[model samples]
Target chain A: MARAIPTRRRWLLSLLAWAVGLIIFFPILWTVLTSFKTEGEAIAAPPHILFFHWTLENYAEVQQRSNYIEHVTNSVVIALGSTLLALLIGVPAAWAAAFAPTRRTKDLLMWMLSTKMMPPVGVLVPIYLLFRDWGLLDTLTGLTVLMMLVNLPIVVWMLYTYFREIPADILEAARMDGARLFNEIVHVLAPMAAPGIASTMLLNIILAWNEAFWTLNLTAAKAAPLSAFIASYSSPEGLFWAKLSAASTMAIAPILILGWFSQRQLVRGLTFGAVK
Target chain B: MATLHTRSLARLMMAPSVAMLFLWMAVPLGMTLYFSFIRYNLLIPGPRSFVGFSNYYYFVTDPAFVAALVNTLVIIGGTLLITVIGGILLALLLDQPIFGQGIVRLLVISPFFVLPTVAALVWKNMMMNPVYGVFAQIARSLGLAPLDWFASVPLLSITLIVAWQWLPFATLILLTALQSLSEEQREAAEMDGARRFSIFFYIILPHLARAITVVILIETIFLLTVFAEILVTTNGGPGVATTNIAFLVYAQALLQFDVAGASAGGIIAVILANIVAVFLMRMIGRNLEA
Candidate 1:
């Protein structure tokens, strides 16, 4: 018996879902809207809900006043750089953990995960001191290394999950055919897991690009990413709504586009290895 | 010889990453533990002395520590409540027949990819500005008084916004679980004359138990350490009402340059997080085992 929800109940549920979704997404929508208003109109009394002159002046000011390109470049370089570094390190490590498990492999994986559980601030002072002493403070290399290390655990974990999904028999077949270990992984494993790897890289790059703590703490000017670019607008000298929104929209636009396009891959990848 | 060579090669491939992560985890943490036991402050640079547990003593006794800890707990608890409930409800709804579901899902997931600083700035400036925000606009249109979200009564509105950014994660995970559920079992319940509510409560909810646990554990780990949002929006402000331990430690170390005190506070936070993490990991491990 196929029992169907009544029309009224279905309508109610749909309306409720739409309302909740809108409420959750309102902030992002409001930000984009405010970016077009004048500074005065952006923070007008009773709030300009709809009636306001839309202008690109705020974006022009944000671009003219701030070194938007430098931060954008820094964000791109660091996010891509750290993600690639994490992958370079994570791939082999995950390969070993997934395929060549020893008595201590699980323990090792757990320990690696526990490191992520530790509060980042617990080590911030030491890292800050270390960075300052090593003269890596405010350097792209410094942020790259730090972000890479922080994001490595997730990379390894995700890759391990993906690797576990590949049948061990295929690798055995390659070995039986006299393929070298490197050739086996390169040919058999890498291609099979490419989708997972690509998604992992995308996710990690997003995480790194969005990271704010180390970027704010370690880098002041030269290595500041889009995160820091947004933070600068948060001056104690009162808020600049239009310009702040403009900067924020600029900062998130690229990742937002990426996310919109790759939503399927992102969702599938994250849930794929976990449920099974 | 080839087998041995392959194993050794595997070990060799793993060594650099292992060693780097090993040092990355140990060196700073080792420094934190050492610093916690010593008398050290950046402003008062001198020969440091080992002060067994006084730093911890002072840190635990400080009201700032208490405030920060409580705030951390409240935010974590508040976020967990909102995300879990909201996520489950949203997932259930999205699982229903819907128009433009993919686009909705993408919009819903978009916030999670947003940079924390940008999200916070967007919320603080464009949405929660109290005066010129959409919330105020709606309130005025509805003939109700507008409320200042960051002020007296609803300081946590910003925290909720930050938590909202993460809600999609919980929804996606849970929704995946929901979709993977055995349809035959649902039909069995239907045949058994189980009411819709009973079917959901008895069958669907239990099927989602594992997903819920995963969501709770992953979200808790991140929520306990939420920093960027607080830093950008509140700065632990409006009278330290929003200060979590991370921000507190940051202020102590960077703003005051009190390395010893900050280290002590940091250790305390680590201990607390570890307690929750242990339970969470155990649950996940057990779930995986099952």
Candidate 2:
């Protein structure tokens, strides 16, 4: 197993791997390619792969048809807003648990984790009624708050995992060097935890961005993010293939790019650092 | 480290998250519990009264509940079977000495990042459409009939789509775990003259056991609540053919306006999830101690 593989076998394996990878990624590739085609070309028999009249018309038409900018704006706001809020609330809790564990802290951690287990459906009716009665429905603030709460446990869990890896010795050394509380955090802890924090934030933003259930149920015209906005295309529309592709491509593009950068964190974060 | 001041400060820091999560869990849950025991319908409002267990009775007795329950299990089981097995094989492939590893990994992992709504729609319209879809095209090219994915096998179609998204996740975690298996250990196994199949079962699968459990537990929890794919594609049916527990509760509340019945269904779903959650919590708790 340690010896170098024969060149022929390597070539064959590489070819097989590449084939599988392309097959897995074909749907996304097809969508992006279809976005550049005319409606007719999108569904053309013996569909065009690269040889087609490529145009930017669908991108423009999609925005005009759906006010796609509004949805994009909403997606940005909700994803960013919820992520920030989760970090704000999660960091301290995670920090406390990681650094200062009491006998009850384990129980407390367990309790927080249990909250994550409570299926959203179990609480859907009351939350919906509350959103309706309190006039929080279809508002960025409401959705942001809901998203924040929805993601809070995960945020805290991920942060706790990262924070646990940080040795107390470094902070103690910083303290011995006459660093104050704020200075120790800013100068010492932040740098050590920065990558993990960035990963957590990126992952949280992507999750919130693509969140569909509450977004579809809670929003209509006003607060609809791209997730809900794209659902409108589900109903039959005339010659909408290219337009749909364009919309989907835009909906996923930002997150897709962000996701590539966060692949390392995806495993760590989703596995709760179990694999790492 | 355990000084009173630090402990107090720790508690203070932990307060907001705990309090918020407590309120989030309690208020809606309490309200759902209350509603589950009473008669409430948004359509026919006014004069609400207690109707102990009747809502549960009706919700469970509804034929849709049985279908939704079975379909939910199918999705959870089907996706788990596909993703876990497929993931192990893919992880093994990616773990090999291959060129352009990064790009191939990028391609493989891209689907996990796609929005469920977008994935659902793309698969429905472009990949699986009976007329003019890629699969249809492939079928025609092969001189075979085009299979209508949603019309014929809605749940299986949903499972395939969901599995496609989750496969990357399983593959990635398993790969990470695989990479961590030291070369020295593998080389030692080779020196001991273990066969390839024996080496994998004895050394590799055992090493992957924890990671596999991690994938299964997390994926099961998430799969239990698959809503967007069904909502966009089948809207829960060619006659409720694809509705799962989450979608069922959703239909009861939003579509049908049966508040009490939906609350009952929601509670039942919660109960169903707890069975998995118990194992998950234990796993995590063990990890914490470790």
Candidate 3:
């Protein structure tokens, strides 16, 4: 490490890293691989590490038994619905705080974040009561609203961080070019901020998709997303590992792909830009 | 040209979010506080008279309260211990110039994306199922009796699952911090004949302290609320053996339908979270000023 000019040491380090990485990743890999194995093979004594007779029966059976598509659609509606709504609210607030240097802006941002700090359980009783009274319990609309508010602070904070980085000169020139406020935001501001907005959206979707507390407590069969989908399998009666594996694999696949692209945003968004 | 007008316009832009967040925060929280001081259980259906601090007193004095509080600490403490120490070691390994590092990073961070319920269920059924789980199979293959994970060491089992989910987060953040260390700093240390341990303790460890703190605080915020994992695996099993304060409050509110008592516990969780929030706010607030 001090002076890296040796091939042998480099090879050894790579092997060690790969070995550890594989260990850290084995559970996920095993889940995915098991999705293709039969129930017996899945729980085989030696445990088929990969050489099982691969089949799509588990996937088909998972869909047949659980209506996987409905769960998938619910997840999309809740995750994207909440994320887009958060953006609808978050983007302008971020813009206002970023472009305007009001003395209270920092306080405003901090206060928004403090809303996030209020643990879900703290308000669970009230929210649950309210939802029950309003007939909003176990509805996609209800979950969307809850998820939006749950992640609203993060959405605002992440968007603000992105918006603050947009150079002022472009907006200035657009204004000088006789662009009205509406046109300025539509043409000039939107394109420049689009990447940041997109990043914030992706991150929020990831958060909303993986949000377990509200998703679990609030929804039942109809409105439950993938979080609840997998939780539904927690107490399965018998010989369901293959199906559980298949369902888990499908539930995480979309978000996992999305998550792969949002690593940088994750660090920034969660940290509230603390590290950077 | 029109500063006051634009400032008001800016205020208008931020108004909806702030108002909604305010309403979202104020209504339920205020409701929780109000219920905390009153006698309100869905099942009991009575005059709903004010109970004063009795709700709080009963809740704190409940035998489950102590166990839950201790378990909460164990989850946070255990997860933090695993993630931070494991994270530092992993970060060091990852920070090296290695082949297929990008693939390795992906493999490492994949767990962070798995929903808690899914992760817990998968771990419980597939890996820790004592009867057919991989861990059991491995233990049996070694001629050792399979340990029933949930029946024994339930908290540690949940802690391991939580740690597995969060280890990637710790690794990624710590690795980000580690990469920021300048090579010149290390080379200079080497020039001074500092050994690998000296370089690590002196050069790397000091640089990573802030990141480690960030990891700890952020993880603590989430870990204190570890509900789904516990729910999916043990259901706070073997008689409140794995129940943390969150699940305890949840059981009180939902299972027992004791709204006032659960509200009291909820308020305590809020207070506990707020104490942590104060620190996080100060730290981030300082960063914002800079």
Candidate 4:
């Protein structure tokens, strides 16, 4: 129970909090606002705060000049594809670890997590070379597989944590009722695990959507996701501020919306359940 | 409670993930090790001969390597300092009773969801550009000169962008931990006439110690490999100014096609990260029992 502060002090604190929050959020807000401005307005000497000659020309031109739909499609496919694949492989592993008591289960879980700590650069050369040799470069399937591999540990860890919370008695009760092994999982486990699985899926998709290192190194124009699409603006020729803003807004808006819903899950997932 | 049939089934279920991860970790890492030992260049497609320690020697002795090592440390250390401190303050503020606290948190965490490329490009052109950037506009309004952020302070600028992206993560985690701190303890301290600073220093800070350690360790892992922000913002430099070890290896492998040299650099990065990983794993491992 927090002490009731004086009303004046509470009001002052509220003002301070709102000011800090708005200032921290200003960059993203500015980008979103700039996305609606004209090229000249975007780079205006005195930047337009609110009142501007607003236009959707940048969004229209961004789509026309660069196939925005294709990049969007690529991002969707890669993010969802990798997340689903990770779930497919991660669920059973987590279920086993959560339900079964083995001396090595803890060790195995730690090892899986330690794999994530290996810097991607350590294996960049081989992965790049292998992708090149196997013609996996600039391929959606390749990127999906790579993303799945990188995020698999988190998926398993999150599911394991969630599954651990569920009582073994439920499964035991099901088994006592003559339910077969497959029937036990299908009937009792899946329904109970749906919420956990969904959050895991959401977080992984967000991670894959924003993954830049592999996407940048492996893909060219053909299979480039939004990360690559936005990065295309890095060079000066692609430096139309309004168009860049439009593209950036498009790239981030979906994930940002998704991310809001998964904020709780994100803390649990990223911290490997250490904080929680 | 466990039957033999179920135990075997558990192992079977775990096989795919275990085997896949094993292959994933072993294959590429083994290849990187092998590549590092040989004189391999992508441009020179001939019989590759064993160069043993020469690749390591050259990669280490290169001037760029030293600069990259220093830049990597600076970026990691700088970003960690900013985010952790900023996060603690923000978390404390948010913990107070405030109007529209939910919306405030939503706004604070928004940047963490922005794609790295998008964040970098947004900062590079819209905020940091000398002529027409927001900073320039602010500077001109104050009758001061606009600073060329990338050219003048490439690494620091990148550090700021990365720190902005990560500050929310630290805040969210710290706030979560703060909420769990026992209220009775605080009330007791307050009743004992401890002022805010005394309570904070003796009680709140100590309670937040584990959370802070977790934040530092986790952030260090991600911060060590900050690539896209640097790649998009500076391309590793006005002149190798922002090139961390990750970018250094990338430039060697992709730009120069020096596979052997790049592999050696990759090994060095792995070693450096492993040192940090060892400590982090121990910290997390201890938490498991609790």
TM (chain A) per model: 0.91, 0.96, 0.96, 0.97
| Model 2 Cα lDDT, one tens digit per residue, A1-276 | 546989999999999999999999999999999999999999999999999999999999988877899999999999999999999989889878988789999899889888888888999999999999999999999999999999898899888999899998888788789897668767888799998899899999989998998999999999999999999989986768899999999999999999999999888777665667
lDDT of 2 at A221: 96
Worst 10 residues of 2 chain B by lDDT: B1-10
Candidate 4 overall lDDT versus native: 0.92
In model 3, which residue pairs have backbone atoms overlapping below 3 Å?
none
- Candidate order by TM-score, decreasing, is 4, 3, 2, 1
lDDT per residue as tens, model 2, B13-42: 899999999999998999999999999999
Error of 1 at A71 (Å): 0.4
State the DockQ of every prediction: 0.56, 0.82, 0.78, 0.85
Residue B279, candidate 3: C-alpha displacement in angstroms: 0.8
Clash pairs detected, candidate 1: none
lDDT of 2 at B123: 97
| Fnat values, candidates in order | 0.59, 0.82, 0.80, 0.82
lDDT of 1 by residue, A91-126 (tens): 998888777776667777777777888888989899
Q: Is candidate 1 or candidate 4 better by lDDT?
A: 4
- Which CAPRI category fits model 1? medium
Best by DockQ: 4
Best by TM-score: 4
Worst 10 residues of 1 chain A by lDDT: A267-276
**Interface Cα RMSD for all candidates?**
2.6, 1.0, 1.3, 0.9
How many backbone collisions does model 1 have? 0
Write the number of the candidate with greater DockQ, choosing between 2 and 3: 2
